[model samples]
Target: MRSVVGGVLSVVVVVAVVACSSPREPLPGLTASATVTTAQTPTPSPTIDYSDAELGIVFEDDQSLTGDEAEVYHWVATLETEYWRTLTTNTVSPKLSSIASPEIHVRMQQMADKNASIEGGHIGGVFRVQVRDVVVEGESARAVACLDYAGATFSDPNGSYTPEEAGFGGISRQELTLARVADKTWIVLTRTAAGEC
Candidate 1:
C-alpha cells in the first residue's frame, strides 16, 4: 500500500512541473514571434533669440537715449543674461570683458567660484534687470536699475532653493557706475545696492 501511494505522489509532482514549464498558445490572429518596440524620447526645443533692443531696459517717459547712453544701457541690461549663462556653463565669458571693469570681473569670478562650491551642484536660473535711469557725464556714466530676483532658482542634490529663500530675492534698486574704455565701449566700474525701488 505505501509503494502504491508513493507512485501516485510522484506522478502528481511530474504533472505540476510540466504544466508550469509548458508554453501557451498565442492569441487568435497573433504571432508568437512579434517584435516589441519602445517609445522614443522627444527632442528639446531651440532657445529663443532676443535682440539687444528688447532686453526690457525701460526708461521713464519713453525718453530717447543718446548713442553712448544707449550702448551703456544695452550692455548693462545684457549682463544679467550673461551671468546666468556663466552659471550654467561653468565658464567665464569673454563678453564680460566688454561689460565689466577689471575689479568687477574679479568679483564676478569669486562669485562663480562660490557657486561651484555649493552643496551638490548649481543649476541655472533667471536674472532680469530693468534700467530705470541712465546718466552719461563725459566719459563716466551712472545707471539706476531694479534687479528682479523673483524668478531666480538654485538647486542642490538634496533640494532646490529660490532667490527669496537664499536671501537674494525681491526688487532691489542697484546703482552702477561705468567708465568709457579706450575701445569706445563702456565698462561697469562699480555696482552697489541702493534702497528698494
Candidate 2:
C-alpha cells in the first residue's frame, strides 16, 4: 500500500512540472500582445534674426538687403559682439569660434590666451563699434567697421596704473574678409587694422 501511494504522488508531481514548463496559449476570445515604442528626436530651434537697426548698425542702403547680404551682415555683427564680450569678461567664450573662420578663430584664441595672463585681473571698459560698410560677392565678402577705444582701460590688480593702460587708443577702422563655408555659414577669413582708431 505504501509503494502504491508513493507511485501516485510521483505521478502528480510529474504532471505539475510539465504543466508549469509548457508554453501557454491564449483561450478563444482572449489575446496576448506586446507593444513597442520608439523615441523621437527633437528639432533644433531656429537662430535668432537680428536687424541692423537692432544692433545699432548704420549702412547706406539698409532698407533693401538681399537674403545673402543680410546673412553676411548679421555674421559680422555677431562676431564683433562676441569679441567685445570676451574682452570685457576676460574669458574665452566658445560662441566666438562659432562665428569666426579658422584663421580668425586662431587669432581670437591667442587674444584670449593673453588675457588669461593678467596677474591681478583687469577691467575692460565699454567701447562702441560702428559698422561702416559690408559688401558681399557670392561666398566672399568684406566688412569694414570702426572700433572706438575711448574710455576703455585695463588697470593692474593693485589699483595702480600700468603701461598696458596706454594701449587703448582712439577709434580704429578694421577690415574683415569673410567666406561662406560649405556649411552655409559665414566665417571671418582675415582681420586687419585698416587705419587709425
Candidate 3:
C-alpha cells in the first residue's frame, strides 16, 4: 500500500531478499582471508564513544558503533533507507537510484510482504534502524542491526489498510565491506545477507 504522512512516504519493506545476479567469486576458500599471520597483532576494540558525530544519525551510545564502524554503519543506514523508499514507490529504477540491482530490490520487497503476512502485517509507519556490533578490520566491517521499523496510517498504495495491518518489527543480520573512496569517506563495495528472523 502507498500513502503520505506529513510529507514522508512510507512503504512496508518485505522480509525477503534476492540472491545476487553475480555471486562474488568466493576467496580461494572460506579460509582464504582467515590465514593466520604471525606479524598481525589484533587491534583492540575502540572504546565506545557514543558522542561521535557520525553516530548522530542513529546511535547515541558507544555500545553499538565506534570509529570507522560508525561511519560505515551510518552510510549503510542511509543507503538502506533510500533503497527501501525507491523500492516501495516503484517510481525510480533500483539500479539507477540504489547501489543494489533492480532484481534484488524486487525480490526483497516480495520477501518483506511474505514475512509481514505471517506476522499479522502493517499498513504504514516510520522506521529507524541501525547497525550493531560492528567489527572493523582495515577497510572491512561486519555488524548486525536493530531495526526500529514501523508504519503509520499515512500513504496507502492500494487505499487499503495493508500498511497499518503490518506494523514493522523485524531483526535481520547484515554484513558490509567498505573500501576507501576518499580521505574521509569509504564506498560500500558489498553487502550480503543470509537468513532472517
The TM-score that candidate 2 achieves is: 0.60
Off by over 4 Å in 2: 1-66, 160-164, 182-184
| 70: Cα error in model 3, Å | 2.4
* TM-score per candidate: 0.62, 0.60, 0.44
What is the C-alpha lDDT profile of model 2 across 85-159, one tens digit per residue? 667566766887777766777777778778778776665555567664679888899988677666455666667
Report the lDDT of model 3 for residue 7.
32
Worst lDDT 10-window in candidate 2: 54-63
All candidates in order of TM-score, best leading? 1, 2, 3
Q: Can you give the lDDT of residue 85 in candidate 1?
A: 62
Better of 2 and 3 by TM-score: 2
Q: State residue 90's C-alpha deviation in candidate 1, in Å.
A: 3.8
| Candidate 1 C-alpha lDDT tens digits along 75-138 | 6665655655666556567788778878767777887788777767665455556675888888
Give the candidate number with the greatest TM-score.
1
TM-score preference between candidates 1 and 3, better one: 1
TM-score, model 1 to reference = 0.62
